[model samples]
Target: MSYHFGRGWSKLTPYLLLLPGLFFYFLISLGPSIATGFFSFTDATGIKGAPIRWIGLDNYREFLFMGRASLDNLDALKRTLIFSFVVTTVQFTLGLIVALIVNQKLKFTNIFRTIYFMPVILGVVIQGLMWSLFLYPLGGPVAKFLALFGMRSEFLGGQPTEAFAWVIFVQIWANL
Candidate 1:
């Protein structure tokens, strides 16, 4: 067995091997979070280099204390939180269930595994578009199916409750 003791390059070999993982961890994970913090402090819009003036904590303060603030933005934020929470919880539960089933020697395991992970392979934009199509009033499958039960009432429109309900429902359904 070839062994080296107190060699210069060999001492740092482990760190060299971990370079790729550390790089990606900082780039993909920490980069966005730091960028979000910076963005939150500025008045940047979707446009790049659009005179991003620093606004400090103004955005968060306004969001918290403004009585007549834009309802659309508030509702969207709420829906985003709801969608994230419900989708994460439901997908984790479903994954555990599938894992247990497969551990018990379920048949066609590979097919089932692929089916469960299919949504993960889909891009976020595509998944959002798919859900939007599915939630459209009177045109989507959900609305059409609800019509059979006389419960069709523009599932993705009309009011905040209806819109958010479909958002959470579709997020959980497709994610699992």
Candidate 2:
């Protein structure tokens, strides 16, 4: 009887030890996800003592089928898709080219690899700050270089198209 009891206890020990972590995971992660899904079908303003009413799929319908909001949402979706496609394609091509070059028996291969790998290891915040400093419209290195060639324009703070291009460039630079 003692041997069977010890075997059963040993079998249950790992699960017993995991109980607290499982409890917290349910409480913190799963609980909120379920609550968010539930709340999505209702009108809850997050105001204390506010009456919550079930609106069903009205909100989703408005977002997807209704007025000016739908147009804006579709435009945003289009831009997001374009951005994802451009970034993925450019990053893959550039990475492949760099990999091929690095694999060759060339002088300064280690140095070239290090230069290409530097942006990947750097934090996003550091990269953003460095780019901002380099591209700052007023008296930045890029602006100064452009001035030397008698061509001056804001790289980041310029017109919408220019700003968008600069953002894409920075994202590719940091990610690659």
Candidate 3:
């Protein structure tokens, strides 16, 4: 009887320990997801004691099939897809190449790996700040470097096309 009881308790212990984590996961992650889905079908103004009514996909229809909003949304979706593809392809290619180089038997392999991994360890906010300072329009390292070549221009705050290119470059660098 004692052996059987011990075996049963041992089998159940892991699950017992997991219960709190599972509970919190449901509370924090799943609860909000379900609530959002439910609210999507209703006209919830989010005001205190506001009347909530079921609108039955009207919101989605308006955003997807209606006037100017649909065009804007489609444009946003296209940009998002393009960004994702470019980032994913570039990151994968660069990562694989770097990994191959780092995996080889070389004297400075550790130093190279550390240099490559530095950006990964840094937080996004810190990376953004660092890049902004480095690319700042006035007296920045990049601006100074460019000025040495008799060229000066705002980097991040420049024209739309240039700014977008810089954004993509910085994103790839940081992510790599």
Candidate 4:
């Protein structure tokens, strides 16, 4: 070993081997995060060759003050919060009940556990896309089922109220 490497070389070798990964992580993670933070202070339209403008706090002010000037905006925000609260409450309640049920000594507990935990195995984006396909317009299961009951309408595309309900439903269903 001593003949193959210079004196003290092995002591530094592990760190040397680690540099590439460290550099790669810095490039992909930290660099992008810092750059994004910086860009948040600037107006970056993301268009090729578009001039970037430095506008500090303007974007934040827009969102934070969006409702104060307009009653419509404030109502929209209230509605959004209500939807969020309902979905979170439903998810928590169902998850707790299912956890308790599965923890009990009963037949088919394994199957029930698997069903409850299956969504947790799926990545968030994959779960969203899977549910979207099953709920989307025209060829979607929801639309076809509705058609059978004399209800004909596009779910994800046409109906905003129904679409929002489905969003909350899927969110709770996937999370629970």
Best candidate, TM-score:
3
Ranking by TM-score: 3, 2, 1, 4
Displacement of residue 154 (Cα, Å) in model 2 is: 4.1
Candidate 3 residues lying further than 4 Å off, grouped into runs, are 1-6, 107-111, 137-152, 155-157
lDDT of each: 0.77, 0.86, 0.87, 0.82
> What are the models' TM-scores?
0.56, 0.67, 0.76, 0.54
RMSD vs true structure, all candidates = 5.4, 5.4, 3.9, 7.4
Q: Write the residue-wise lDDT of candidate 3 on 1-176 in tens digits.
A: 35442675687877898999999999999999999999999999999999999999998998788999899998878877878888889988998999899899999999998989988899999988998899898999988998999998864457766776677777888887
lDDT score, candidate 2: 0.86
Tens-digit lDDT string for candidate 1 (12-92): 878888999999999999999999989998888979657889999998988766766756568768877877887898878
Q: Residue 164's C-alpha lDDT in candidate 1?
A: 67
Question: Candidate 4: which pairs clash?
Answer: none
How well is each residue in 1-176 modelled by candidate 2, as lDDT tens digits? Answer: 35432675687877898999999999999999999999999999999999999999988888878999899998878878988999999989998898899899999999998988889788888888888899887899988988999988755457777777788887887787
